[model samples]
Structures are given as C-alpha cells and as structure tokens.
Target chain A: QQQVKQSPQSLIVQKGGISIINCAYENTAFDYFPWYQQFPGKGPALLIAIRPDVSEKKEGRFTISFNKSAKQFSLHIMDSQPGDSATYFCAAGLTGANNLFFGTGTRLTVIP
Target chain B: EPEVTQTPSHQVTQMGQEVILRCVPISNHLYFYWYRQILGQKVEFLVSFYNNEISEKSEIFDDQFSVERPDGSNFTLKIRSTKLEDSAMYFCASSVRLATNEKLFFGSGTQLSVL
Candidate 1:
C-alpha cells in the first residue's frame, strides 16, 4: 500500500517563477513531514521539514504548507532557479518511529 | 557537515550470488537505516538499526536480506541470494537520534545491478 501519494511526476518552471509540489498521506500517526531534494546520481538530501503543529513553515525561498485536517502538505519554491531543479520528495513519519514513507517524487526543471 | 559513506559506488553481480553492501555512518550518529530506490520509483525503507540491532524493517526485507554492524564503525547489508529484481540504488543514512523528525545524513548510494 502506498502510504504517501504525490502528483505531477514532472514539472517545469521558468527561472524567477514559483514551483509547487503537493503530497497526501494516509497514515494519521504521521507527525513529521519533510521534503528532500535529490540530484542526479546522489542521495536525497534534507531540504526542509515541518511538524503538524504549524500551518506553514518557511525557510528562505522554500516553504512548506501543511493542512493537518486534510492530511496533505505542499512545498513551494519562490523565485525558482536553475540550480533548484532536482527531484523533490515528500516524506511522512511518526514522532518516535525510525522509518519514513516517501512519495514517488517530482522532477522539477527550472529553465532560464 | 558529517555524512554517511558507502563503499563501491557500483556493483554488478550474477543472479543467485551473494553480495554485501558496506557503509560507514557518521561517527556520532546512533541510528542507522537502509533505503532503496528502484529506477523511477519512490524510495522505500528496508530496515533501521540502533544499538547493534534492527529496530524495524519493512515487508520488502525478507529472509534473503540481513543487516549487521560487525564493527563499531561499520554497518553492512547482505543479500544471501541476489535476484534480478534486487537491482536498485541502496542508500545508507544516519542520525544523531531515533526521532523521525531528526535530520538524517545520507550517503550517495551503491548502485547494485543483478544479472
């Protein structure tokens, strides 16, 4: 069973535009939501994360908007750049658990 | 920043042969994890280890798979018999704490190809 589902397998955005990716999770036990950025031939790196306590969290140009009632979260990249083009994955996990359920991933391309 | 290290960035093995993927997690990290990503697929958790034992594992981890921390600094995953479907990119990750919220440092990966 897929615990987390993501949409828009691929995305393209012009530089300086906004890029958005969305994900939904089925497990309510999940309290930690994180977004990971992966480059070709590299492992996924932690980009930004948020707890269910907040409706939104922002780190520079990266923002995570979470809706607990909807069991959904989305990542928004403002002023997207070519360097930001990479595979983005949304993951969910429990507070004390050691495993994370990851989304299928969205490959973003920021064209100049 | 400290990072997890995996050896033999790429490995090719014949089917039914045994293969062991090695990893050296961050020195100060107490939690270790193994995750795999099949081509064009989502990353899946295989197992988690802490205090020298497996804390949790997913259904994909069957009897064919095993994990070990033979030395204080090294963690390894062994597949007794490689299957064609085992071809994937294996990642090793480590964290300072067990909380899922904690940041996990990941190694680039070991691309295993089973023929």
Candidate 2:
C-alpha cells in the first residue's frame, strides 16, 4: 500500500507543448503529495505539492491534478520549455509518517 | 529557501572499510533522514531521526548501520563495514517537522564508491 508507480519512464515534447507525467498510489492513507524536480549533480527540489483535500493545484505553468477516488495524480507542464527538462518524481506521505514513498521517476524533455 | 547540505561530495573506499556519511540539515528543522540511490534505481529510505532519537527505519537499515546527532550542527550515518553493493549516492534530508504540512528538503548528496 506504500508504493507509488509513475508512468511514461520518459517523455519528449516540443517547445510550447504540454508535457504530462502520471503517478498512482495504493496507499489511501496518504494525505500529502509532492512532485520533485532534479537536475544533474543537484538535489531534488520541491516543484509543487497538493493535499488530497483539493482536486488540483497550479503554480505558474505547472499543474498537479489529483483524483482521490482513482488513487491517481498527474503533473502537467504547459508551454513546456527546454529549461523544464529534468527528472521528475512523485511522492506521498501521511500524517505522522516518517518516510515518503517515491515513484520510479519520469524524465521529461522539451525540444526547442 | 534553506536546504540540507552533505559533505565529501564523493568518497571511494575499499570493501569492508568503515564509512561515515555526514549531513547538516536546515538549522531549525526538527526531523532528519537518510536516503540512498543505487545507480539506475529509485531512491530508498534508510532512516529517520527526530528529537535526537530514531523514529523509524527501513529494513535496509541493519545492525551495521547507525545514525548519530553527535552534536547540534550535524547528523551522521555510520556503516561499520561496507560492501561493493553499498556503492551509491547518499542523500540527507530534513523537514520543519514530520507532519502532513511539512515537506522534506534534500541535500545535493554524497556519492559513495566501494571498491
């Protein structure tokens, strides 16, 4: 129930296009979900996050859509730019949880 | 904006040698954690520390592994005897506190190479 599975091991989109990555979790207890972006030689940084209470959350060009009943979530990057190319990870944790369950990760590439 | 930082960005040690990975979490953060990534694999959780005590740990964290808050400014992961399979990138993370409202901040990570 702690596993999070991410799909589309890799994705490539043209500039100004939409890039999507999907993740699903089996743990209904998870209340906190986050997406992390990582670059070569750098630590994974928090990109955006959402609580199960909301269906979606947007930060600029990044949007996270959550489906509680479906036990799934997705990340959409609008107007995908080359700068957006990197490894993205989806994670989940519950209240009082000591560890965050992570997905396999997706590599997104935006061709300019 | 505060982030966790790790030391000795890269370390190469011989098999069976002792290894210690160090980290300096955000000053005010109350929870600290250790994670590792084997090349081409997903990151794996090792342990979590809170109130200067271990709150939880994964099965991967065996007797050979131990964590210490040693002093106020640092947290450390000690491996009594390393093996070739132990080679990987070690990441240290911290959080405001271990709750639903807080997110973990990660370090750049230290690459451990066991030869």
Candidate 3:
C-alpha cells in the first residue's frame, strides 16, 4: 500500500513566482512529515520538516503547510529561483516506525 | 555538521557475484538505515538498525540481502547474488532518535551496476 501520495509529477514555474507541491497520506499514525530536495547525481538532502501539531513552518525560501484533518501537507517555495530546480519528495514517519514512507517525487523546474 | 559517508561511489559487479557496500554513519547518531532508489524511481526503505540490532526491515530485504555492523563505526550491506535488477543507488542515513524523525543525514550514495 502506498500510504503517501503526491500530485504533479512535474512542475514548472517562473523566477520570483510561487511553487507549490502537495501530498496526502492515509496513515494517521504518522506524526512527522519531512521534505527532501535532490539534484542530479546527488543524494536527497533534508530541506524542511514539520509535525502535525504545527500548521506551518518556514525556513528561508522553503515552507511546509500541514493540514492535519485532511491528512495532507504541502511545500511552498517563495520567490522561486532556478537553483531551486530539483526533485522534491514528501515523507511521513510514525513514532513506532522509524522508517519513512516517501511519496512519488515532484520534479520542480524554475525558469529564469 | 556530521554527515554519512559511503565508499566506492560506483561499483560494477557481475551477476551472481557477491558485493558489499559500506557506510559510515554520523557520529553520535544511534539509529542507522539503508535505502535504495532505482533510476527515476522513488526512494525505498530497506532496513533500519539500532543498538546493534535490526529494528525493522522491508519485504525487499530478502534472502539475497543482509546487513551488518561488523564494527562500531561501519555498517555494511551485502548482496549474496547480484542481479541485473538489483542495480540502484544505495544511501545510508542516520538519525539521533527514533522518537523524532526530524533530520536524517544521508551519504551521497553508492551506485551499483549489475552486469
């Protein structure tokens, strides 16, 4: 069972625009949600993460908005830049299950 | 910032041959995990280890695959009989606590190519 689902296999945005990627999960047991950014030939790096208790979290240009009731969460990139171009993955983790369940990645490309 | 390190960034192995991939997880991190991603595919979990024992594992971790922390500083994944389909990028990650999945530091990964 693919517990987590992601939308928009690919996304294209202009510089200085807002880029958003959404994800939904069925396992309510998940308490932690983390987003990873990966580039070609590179390993996935931790970008930003949030817990169900918090609705939103912002770190510089990256932000995570969580909707606990809907079992959905999203990543928002403000003033998107070309450097932000990469594959983004949303993952959910349960307290008992340390392993993460990753969603199908969304490849984001920002045109300058 | 401590980070995981992997050896032999790329490996080409013959089918049915045994191959071992090594990793050095971040210091002070007690929890370690192994994950793999086939080209153009989503990352999939293989196994997780803690306190010198396997905490969990996925179905993909079968008869051909095994994990060991031979020593305190190194973790290794051995494939007994490599198959063409086994080719993928293997990543090692470590976290501070199982209670919180906050940040997982990952190594660049070892790209395995089965021929």
Candidate 4:
C-alpha cells in the first residue's frame, strides 16, 4: 500500500514565478514531514522539514504548509529559479522509527 | 559536510550471480539503512541496521537479501541470487540519531543491472 501520495508528476514554472507541490499521507503516527531535493544522478538532499506542531514553516524562499487534520502538506517555492529545477520528494516518518515513507516525487522545471 | 560514500557507482551482473554493494557511512553516524528506487518509482526502504544487526526490514527484504557491517567503518548489502527485477538504484543512508527529526545523509547510489 502507498503510505504517501503526491500529485502532479511533473511541473513547469517560469523564472521568478511560484512553484507548488502537494502530498498527503495516511498514517496518523507520522509526526515528521520533510522535503528532499534531488538533481540528476545525485542522491536526495534535505531541503526543508516541518513538525506537526506548527501549521507552517518557512526557510528563505521555501515554505512548508502542513494540515494535521487533513494529513496533508505542501511545499511552496517563491521566485523560482532555473537552478531550483529538480525532483522534489515529500516524506513522512514516525518519531522513533528508522524508516520513512516517500512520495512518488515531482519533477519541476523552471524555465527562463 | 560529511556524506555517505558508495563504491562502484554502477554494476552489471548476470542473473543468478551474487553481488555485494558496499558503503561507508559518515563516521559518527550510529544508524544505517538501505533504500532502493526503480526507474520512475518512489524510493522504498529495504532494511535498517544498528549495533551490528538489522532492526527493521520491509517485505522486499527477503531471504536472498542480507546486510552486514564487516568492520567498524564499512556496511555492505549482498544478494545471493540476482534476478532481472532487481535492477534499481540502491542507496545507503546514515544518521547520528534515530529521531524522526534528525537528518539522514544518503550516498549517490549504486545502479545495479541484472541481465
């Protein structure tokens, strides 16, 4: 069974525009939600993360809005740039568990 | 920043052969994990190791798959008999703590192709 589901398999945005990706999870035990960015032929790296305690968290131009009741979270990138174009994945994990459930991933392309 | 290192970025093997993928995680990390991603698919967790033994494993980790920490520094995953469906990118990750909030550093991955 798919624990986490993501929408918009691919996305395209113009430079300086906003890019958004959404994900929903099924398990209520999950308390940590993180977003990872991956370039071609590279491993996924941590971009930003949020705990269920807060409804929203922002780091520079990146923001994560989480809704606990809905079990959904979304990532927003403001003033998107060509360099920000990459595959973004949303993951959820329990407090002490060693495993994480990852989304299918969204490939974003920021065109100049 | 420290990173996980994997050897032999790509490997091609005939079906029914044995293959071992090696990794050297960050020095201070205490937790190790193996994950795999098939072409255009979501990343799936295979197994997790700590204190020289497997703590958790997914259904995908069957009898053919095994993990070992041969020494203090190296972690390895071995497949006794390769199958065509085993073609995927295998990633090694490590973290200093087991908390969900802690970051997990991952290696670039080893692309395995079974013929």
Interface DockQ of each model: 0.81, 0.68, 0.62, 0.76
Candidate 3 backbone collisions, by pair: none
**Which residue pairs clash within candidate 4?**
none
lDDT of 3 by residue, A44-98 (tens): 8989999988999999999999999999999999999999999999999886786
Error of 4 at A89 (Å): 0.7
Give the better candidate number (1 or 2) by lDDT: 1
Better structure of 1 and 2 per DockQ: 1
Candidate 4 docking: what grade?
A: medium
Tell me the tens digit of each residue's lDDT in model 1 across A19-99. Answer: 999999999989999999999877889999999999999999999999999999999999999999999999999988989
lDDT of 1 at A14: 100
CAPRI tier of model 3: medium
Q: Rate the local accuracy (lDDT) of all candidates.
A: 0.94, 0.91, 0.90, 0.94
- Which regions of candidate 4 fall more than 4 Å away from where they truly are? none
Q: Give the per-residue lDDT of model 2 (tens digit) for A1-112.
A: 3488888889999999999999999988999999999988888888999999899999999999999999999999999999999999998888887988888789899999
Tens-place lDDT per residue, model 4, A1-112, is 9999987899999999999999999999899999999998788899999999999999999999999999999999999999999999999999889899999999999999
- The list of candidate 2 runs beyond 4 A from truth reads none
